[model samples]
Target chain A: MRPPPKSWPPTKGSEPLPNAPRIAPPVSAARPAGKLRGARALSGPLPWLLPALIMLGLFYLYPIAEALRLAFTDARLFDQATEPSLDSIRRVSQSAALPVILQNTLVYTVASVLGQLGLGMAIAILVVRAERARLRGTMALRTLVLAAWVIPAIANGVIWQLLFSEAPFGAINSALRMVGFAPVAWLSDPSNAMLSAVIATIWQGTAYSMILLYAALKSIDPALNEAAAIDNATGFERFWFITLPHLRAALLVNAILILIMTLNMFDTILSLTGGGPGRATEVLSLFAYNTVFQSFELGRGAVLSILLLIISLTLTAAMVVFLPRERK
Target chain B: MTFRAIPAAFALLATTAPVWAEDLITRNRVGPADAPNALTFRLTAFDLYSADPATAAHFGDLFTDFILAHPGWRIDTQLQTGAIAQEQARIIEQTRAGRGPDCAMIDSSQLATFKEAGLLAPMTPFFTQEQIDDLFPFVREGVTDANGDIAALWWFTDLRVLYRDVTLVPEPPQTWADLQQAAEVVAAQGLEGILFNAGRDEASAFDWLAHFWAQGGELVDDTGRPVFFEGENREKFLSAVAFFADLVESGAAPRRVTALSSYDDLLASAVAGSTGMFIGGNWMYNQIQITMPPEQAANWAVSELPGPTPEQRATGTGGWTIAALTDDPAKTEICAGIAQLYAGPGNAFQGLLPTSVSLFEEFETFAGPEFDVFVSALQNGRARPSVPIYPEISNQIQILLGNVLSGSMTAEAALDEAAAEVMAAYERL
Candidate 1:
């Protein structure tokens, strides 16, 4: 008696056993179509996702296409003439504002994502640890963080503005004065203004990451921790080996979402700094808004919106491709 | 065991019969809310109409008179709280959709753009030649369209004044140098020396325009091209920026001035007793009186905006205008009549000066010393250039002020940059 050749996966073009289960039905065979129509040419999820596809096409695809069309035209907000030209592109390209705005957007988004992720991970772990130890008031802590998350960005802007305002109006400055320290220009200085905006965004956005990472943390088996303890694994070693590997997918999802949110952030910065102290906190989204509404140059604004859309999509695509490689 | 549905329906109709019958009369028979007139006048007014009791009462009186003639003329009003520019933008959108209100209160500077868009019906059908003659020069100029028709009624205006806390600044500064020194003294005393609307908004641009005008600088030519950077005008522009730059650099004005977008903000600081002097509109003083304690309000007074020298004087006057946006003659007439009810240089809602010849004499408070300063300021008062490209110029100027105030760019560099941006936009036009 002999074991046949020990190759596990069948090689290409290898013959299958006569009694082996058939891989799907033969294409030549006809199947009755009721619910699952696998054999059909238009098979699988496309039909199931038709409604969402239609929505995306109508809302997302159409707006992007229209914006692209408008980008090359000379359009003012109220003007009816729609002559196609490169003036919008030329204006944005030659604009001194573009460089400053892009830099601000980058700084704001990167700082916000990093802050949200790191603070979120730490909070999520602490809360889970406290719950395991039967600590009280963890629910209250969660509610407070969630309160910041639930607040509208515009309201957050006003709240942060009052907190960041100078001497008499701002609590922060008043406290510094009480402590016999010179008041920091939280909203007046360019660098300070950007920092203030980033900090405010992080506070508002950290809840999103915390909830996601918390769910991931809960999914991690307590048995694994016990086993690692039995192996005499240190606290850091257990977290690095058992907990972090389990959270890889959530962290990736959280980073991508936070990146998109921070990139699109405008309402907070708008009310907080209004992109001032000399365009120091002016992100791309706000720049586009000012171009269209404030400056009334729709063509140039359209050009800026397209640039923003490209950056958002490119970053999302990169995260999709790059983040998964870490898993390997 | 159950009641019949018919009786319940009958009871419901009986309960609402009066309301339904009244509504039917308003919608179908004669006038909606009033007498026999079959028209409803829709107006989009600023927030004061809805928010201020005095303003609402004044309109209430006007409506009482209107219904006597228009009998059955129902009034429907919508209120907006945004600044004039936003209100104008909203109207423009509705106008494009062919669904604008019969009447809209717009910023005076918006008149030119509205006319260019063909969104306004000529006010000549409403305002008479005699009425036109009575308007302030800037109002007359602003309301007149390219075809020489009065397009909108500029009812009230506010003049930029040099506001001072009398305790901090004994006398109003008459010139830039005097202002600089006075503000320095205030700043040295640990008070905010001066404040102005310098944020990226119409107010900031409108406020800064006086500085250029005081130097005899013109922003645009007859062809609507920007002439601000040409020859001597360039020097004037440079000098104007330098004057403000000096205020910021010498600690006379706080660096926050670059971001102070609204007179409302300056008013807040003034009422809190932190501000020493500021250049603000006359309405700001009126607000101070309303919100500040009498003793505090007494310390605040307004004078005409200072100039390069005491003899050189100029001021910026901005006002709101009401326009008939509908082509329906009947609706337009109703709109015109409504506007005329409160027409003159008076606002019941805010204590802004009349836009034209006085009709506010009925109110004795209009005779106050602050208004006397406003009256003199009217002599040099000018409206913003209503040309469409003026917004672009203002936007660039906003950036320039921010740059110079931050000490990021020199005055010359900032001016050149602003000029280049404005010219590029002009070329595109």
Candidate 2:
């Protein structure tokens, strides 16, 4: 059996001489040198990515590895006698407050994610579907929404705490009293503390979801909508079949990001509740922090942190597997 | 050989000359008639001390006056905090490398660690015997190193008190039984009787320690060994714990008292009218005055912490101490002199306390009536156990007490467990 022709540089002569080795012409020719040069220029900035990767490895990866190691060691601030053991892990598992903390964390995360996403989607659709004549003021309104996102998390917590203060002097309580209602202890009551935190977090986080969904909504082809309309399809029908699918990728991305952010929420909770009202609003992050700083149980605190990391990683992995991957 | 010998001779002279001069300077500096020459001194203020401009100014004035009296001395002061922990770590690292601070205002607890590490200089030579006698005995005991040498001087004192609303309770409770009865009345009127630090942390331990001590319970024996498990003291402590548990469970105290992680939390609860009384210290008076309205502030008053038995009345006194950290004998003496000036009677150290004995004699006023209770409490205060393993012991007490109060463990069982843990820590120490 003869081997197939080699695809390489073409032969010098066109005519075949006696017993000339069979050679095939190049199947597809290269592009012009300018095109190649343009591609090279585009790839030139890729080297800058190395520094960013190195930073992530140092600041993010190294600390996480260290935390995992510390979690398994008997590390405490003052107590020198405690040997490393599974005691902390056992304590965490058997903790009476564990179930409640887990429940509260999940509830806060899910509720905030759904509430923010729904609200953000509605606002995004409104702004996109608005007539051109009204889009000017609508754009300004979007900017105002973005401003809420711009406030730092700690500052947001402070503002909400002031607003929710139980005293009659508080802004919300004062307003409630003016309307002939009794003042409510927003922070001191366990029933209200978690809900208060959720509201504050959602208020700040919804803008983020809105921006992503809005960008996705704007990118949907108008021609498809026009075609749907000509076929007597209603606005709702167009959104359901055409626009909704277009936003599926963005929604999944936004949901996963929001879930991770909410799961790791600490600053706002620390400033507002400090896991107060008898640990009613305690989340995993705050639990980990108190274990270390307040109790000086570094090993136990590290264990909690490791658990949080595992949960975050598992959820991220699930998102990757379950969400529809975007096609090129 | 001649050149090398010349360098060696000069080096020996150079080193020995300073030694003789230092000895001569020290001898002359302490003479009755001749005053020491002015020395340059540097001091650093902790963030908490520098929080208020007036407080900082007063400290500055006191230091300047001391320098003015000592003709050869000039004082330099720096205000710092964020780098405090790092600076402390660096000091230890440097000491291991053979260097450290001249003087530092260290927490009384940290003094134990430093003393154990053999990094502190004894201040007996710097302070005269009469001056030492004038110091509070409890403060003197707390500042003494294991070798019986005075290693530091106490700058300020803190003590616990039971603060109540005068309009609501009229007279504050003075005994444990009275407090329980008053708590019932307060609860009946729809207000919390007392706010306890039930959080599982150091504050919780400190709060509970006051109660435990008030019941005549000693966490450790005279020999500095754990003895919380056996004898009448254990029963008395458990009885107090039972009373506290009853108070919390009967809805007298806030049901969520376990969530009170900070003094600010208690203050907020009191200001919100959820609580009518709280166990706090002199610090809370200033905080309350700041957060409460004038009318509300007027309604508040303080009294000595209630005792388990009338004879068992006791308050724990703990505070910051200033210690010299340098190896140089002359510099250490100068730093000690500076500490003496700050902590000396009738000086700015009195200002550090809102109701010190000196403050009472000089100002003839307290920050408020709330502070009077603190003054009395301080007058009758017993110092907290000065064991080096205090942090670990405190943690065990807090966890055990919290569990007992929460009904997860019986008082006897909790005490046994805590005693065991404390003994383990003591052994390690």
Candidate 3:
């Protein structure tokens, strides 16, 4: 009788075997405590991260919130009056120097960021190639590139200031005299003040970009270069295709960071130009500082600070949105 | 066995009779490292040590002598250095916290601010009426509160005067026209003919106010109202702006003159021979001597600032004052004594003028020949308006002058704007 039917087991189970291994109904897809498995796992890490969160809340978010709140008040450092108003914002908006300050800030941000990026990328590539070629003293050369980054920005500013001074003993003027060219008022002339500040800033900030780019370059697999070389690609073509594609993430991040740094820079300009030659180099940061500490117009300064924060945040958001995404 | 023996020995000692049998040793009561009674005086000034070593040393000596005289009281002096504005801010913070020095060296310009902040103690309690009256009227006014009580002690004074290179100008300019003519001649000689503190700060205002006063401008009237917007004051403000603007426009002064923020900058320009003339304080004489070669120093001389007319000559008298910040009468008296010694007569500042009229003769003898010009300047000079809003007023003047000098605005337009802004600031105050 068993050999009589080849389809003894029906294609569809019309009937179940009573003695077959009883399996419990598939466990209900429910998470404990009505939470995802990893959701509650954050608690283990939360204690470890509490300090950093507290620090950011206190030092970063707190100041920003306070500044925003103050932007609506007519606050003075020494005044006891606490009248809440938008007069400061209105006053800042109507200021005549506001246009010039914005222009300078824009020019400075563009020039310095571009300068740093261009120089940083070039130097990073060169150093990477030098190392690949086993060139002697490449390490020393790289370290030299990092020198400006190691020195404090204010000290760097002062050094550049001395070099750019209109004084006869200034390094730039002395060099010009040696070359029989007329000494240029590097810092004193309105035309040159912002340019001088940009140059000083680039000198200091290039190292940061270079460092990031260099690390990115090193992370790039050398096998890609080898493959390109085998395909008869030139150095430029290899870098354009293989190296650059890998560096997109680093380049975008570095650009954002440098842009923010340049926008917020205050002490360097304070020490170097003092926003002088008729406020020629007075960026928003300097203007905010002057309004707050120097002029003691706290509310006006807060207004400027809020504007700066908004600009920075907008730019950051734009960059994050528009920049190419990294491969998963 | 050892524990039992130790307890027995301790018990024997504890049971010993006459615990106070040994004569109690008498010694001087313990005190701080300083003498039993010590006074710590804190002073904040621009340059207590490096700016003028002799004066700083004299102060140290005076404190030393005071300690020597007062047998029980040891004197302790703590000096901090920074811009006078910064010092004033620090003093304000310290006083508000009730932890400031017993006294602070306040700038004459800072008196109004300190008084308004209620940081100053009236000097009437510590100083005699005769002594208060003996100060120069402007000096007295600088340290006097709204109620006409002396709020601080004025000791040494400074007057803004015209500094010139003797080789370029054999005689100081007697009028604004003379100054212009001299500047033109000096400019023709391929030198920056003039360097005023055309900087966009209080220095510019301080320098321009001399010209403003000469042109008969008043920052605030006797009734403490801003009157710069009308009549003679408006005209004078306009004229002063035009004069400064002309210096920059005509290339008589360096276009870089717009960058000179401090008298120190002018002094440097003078010492470097880059400027043929400048307006600065008499304190520059010592700085010139300290910073310049003998020949270079000799080439520079100071005179009373030129006026619109010889009869209309004016200068600015500014100085530092010692404001008593302590509530303790004893501390206040001690601070007053130190302030008097530092700024009072017979200290022989040696080119620095004393603020007291009573000390003029004695100061003149030690102040040397250059101080004669300073004396004339002091006699003719007026203190800037000691209103709480003076800093704001001064800043507006600086902005106006800076705008004119930079060709951003015409003198008439700039002064009009400045006058309006100043009145607004006054109203706010």
Q: By DockQ, who's the top model here? A: 1
- Backbone collision tally, model 3: 0
Order candidates by TM-score, high to low.
Answer: 1, 3, 2
With a 3 Å backbone cut-off (N, CA, C), the pairs that clash in candidate 3 are: none
Q: On lDDT, who's better, 2 or 3?
A: 3
- For model 3, how does the per-residue alpha-carbon lDDT over B3-61 read when each residue is reduced to its tens digit? 88998997888754322232111121111233566555556533334356666555545
DockQ of 3: 0.22
Estimate TM-scores for all models.
0.87, 0.70, 0.83
Better of 1 and 3 by lDDT: 1
What is the C-alpha lDDT profile of model 1 across B293-399, one tens digit per residue? 88888888778888999988899888777788887777777777766765631264446577666455656657778778888889999888878888788778887
Q: Tens-digit lDDT track for model 2 on B252-349?
A: 77545554546776787778876678887667877777899999888888778888776667776766677777766776777787766655432333
User: Model 2's lDDT to the true fold?
Assistant: 0.69
| Worst 10 contiguous positions by lDDT, candidate 1 chain B | B23-32
**CA lDDT, every prediction?**
0.79, 0.69, 0.76
Candidates 2 and 3 compared by TM-score, better number: 3
Candidate 3 versus truth, CA RMSD in Å, comes to 10.2
